[model samples]
Structure formats: C-alpha cells, structure tokens
Target: MARIIGVDIPNDKRLEISLTYIFGVGRKTALDVCRDLNLDPGMKARDLNEIQVTEIANHLQKNYNVEGELRRTLAQAISRLRDIGCYRGLRHRRSLPVRGQRTRTNARSRKGPKKTVAGKKSVKK
Candidate 1:
C-alpha cells in the first residue's frame, strides 16, 4: 500500500484508480493530477518510486482540498447550513434525504429501520 495524504492506497491498482482511494479525489481529478504531475496513470501504485510518491503527496496537498481538509471543509459547510436553518439543513438535521427524495417509501436507507404504526381496525355488529 502506498500512503498518500494519510490514506493507504492499494499497490496493486493503477495509479489513477489508487488515487481515488483518497477522499474527494474522483476519476477525473485523479486523471488530472496524474497529467499535471507527469505521472503515468496506468502505472501501478507499487511501481511508484519514493520520490514520485512524495511528489504526488506534495502536489495534492499544495493544490487541492483532500483527505482531512476536504472532510473538514464539507462538515463546516453542512454545519453552516444547519446553523442558518435552511430547508436542506432541516432535512439534514432530521436525517432525511435532502435531495427531494420521497420519504413515503424507498428512503429507508436514510430514514433507517421502519417504525411501524398500528393500523386502525373496526368491527360492526
């Protein structure tokens, strides 16, 4: 495993794919980084020399918000929204889907396990 930005990326995977193991780095961003650093995207992570690995780490740290920094920035943004009491924030606060997903059904992943309410029943003589 190659440690980059405090994350251990799989050595068996290609450089571009391995880079995605780091938070906030997607396929496109990984490709861009590889291009910018003049590293071969198809190269396996284990093939990276120590200097190349350090260069990648430095480049990412200097030019991008990633790992802990990216996580903190996102958390701050969400907290700010919650503090402002926006509709999205309210949804986030309530642990509901914030993207207009219907809570009537199929949001169980976000809404968690179902808490069934007793249904009314009537009997007539």
Candidate 2:
C-alpha cells in the first residue's frame, strides 16, 4: 500500500485510480496530479519510490485542500444550505434524494424496505 496525502492507496490499482481513494481527488484531478509530478498514470502504487511518493504528497499539500479540510468544507456547504431552508436542504432533512432522482421507482435503496399491508378476512355465508 502506498500512503499519499495521508490516505492509503491500494497497491494493486494504477497510480491514477489509486490516487482517487484520497478525499478531494477525483479522476480528472488524479490525472492532473500525475501530470504535475511527472508520474506515469499506468504505474502501480506499490511500485512508486519513496521520493516519488514524497513529491506527490508535497504537491497535494501545496496545491490542494484534501482529506479533513475537504470534508469540513463539504459539511459546511451542506450546513449552510440547510440553514438557508433551500429545497435541497429540505430534501436532505427529509432523507430523500437530492439530485432529482426518481423516487417513485428505483430509490428503494435510499427509502428502505416496503411494509406489507394485511388483508381483512371475509365471513362465510
């Protein structure tokens, strides 16, 4: 396993994909980081030398807000939305999907299991 920017990256994955395990880095940002550090995107995380890993860490720390900082920023954004009583905040408060996903059908994963209704018995004639 390679530790980059205080996150543990899986050893089996390519450097580009492995870097995405870090909090603030996505696919595009991972590619950008690799490019900036002159690292091969196809290289495995475990194959990176200590110097390369150090360089990557330095680059991330200098140029990007990641890990705890990124998490705190996201939390603050969500809190602000909730405080302002926005529609998205209402969805969040109600525990529904916020991205305009159809709740009438495939949102069962978020909505949890359905309850079964009991039928009334008929008397014999």
Candidate 3:
C-alpha cells in the first residue's frame, strides 16, 4: 500500500488517475507531473519502484500544495471574502449559491432538504 502526500492512492489504478486522489491535483496536473518527471502515466501505482514513488512525492511537495495545506489556503481565501462583506461573501455567509445561479426552484443541493409550513394550502383564483 503505497502512500503519497498522506493519501493512499489505489495501487492497481493507472498512475495518472491515482495521482488525482491527492487533493488539488486534477487530471491535467497529473499528466503534467508525468510529463515533467518522464514517468509512464499508463503505469499502475503498484508497478512503480521506490525511486519513482519518492520522485513523485518530492515533486508534489515541492511544486504543489495538497491535502491539508490546500484546504487551509482555500479556507483563508473564503474567510477573507467574508470579512470583506462582498456580495459573494454575503451569499457564502447565508449558505446560498455564490455564482449567481437561480435559486427559486433549483439549488436544493445547497439549500438542503425542503422545509414546509404546517397546514399550508394553495388556493386558486
């Protein structure tokens, strides 16, 4: 069970896809890492030797912020926005969509389960 950057990526998966198990690393970044390191992206994580694993860990630690650090950095940015009290910040503060998406009918995912009033009835004119 090889671990990288404190995350246990699946050993049977392809290197490029396994790399995405680390937070903040997407498919493009994983491909770039493979290109930069001259590694075979199609190789499985279990097939990698110790040197290759170490190279990936070192490269990620040196050039990217993942896991806890990335999470903290994002939290700080959102906190800064909230402190500034901007429109987006207000939306964040209210647990509403921050990207100007319609909320009248959709946004149930963000707004959580529906809440209904007791004995509420609709009347037709």
Residue clash pairs of candidate 3: none
Q: Of the candidates shown, which would achieve the greatest lDDT relative to the real structure?
A: 1
Candidate 3 lDDT by residue in tens digits, 1-125: 67888999999999999999999999999999999999999999999888988999999989999888999999999999999999988998988999999999999999888887699579989
37-124 per-residue lDDT for model 1 (tens digits): 8999999999999999999999999989999999999999999999999999999999999999898879999999999999988878
The total of clashing pairs for model 1 equals 0
Per-model TM-score on C-alpha atoms: 0.94, 0.81, 0.90
The TM-score measured for candidate 2 stands at 0.81
The list of candidate 3 runs beyond 4 A from truth reads 118-125
- lDDT accuracy of residue 51 in candidate 3: 91
lDDT of each: 0.94, 0.89, 0.92
Worst 10-residue lDDT window for candidate 2 reads 108-117
Candidate with better TM-score, 2 vs 3: 3
Ranking by lDDT: 1, 3, 2
Angstrom error at residue 85, model 2: 1.2
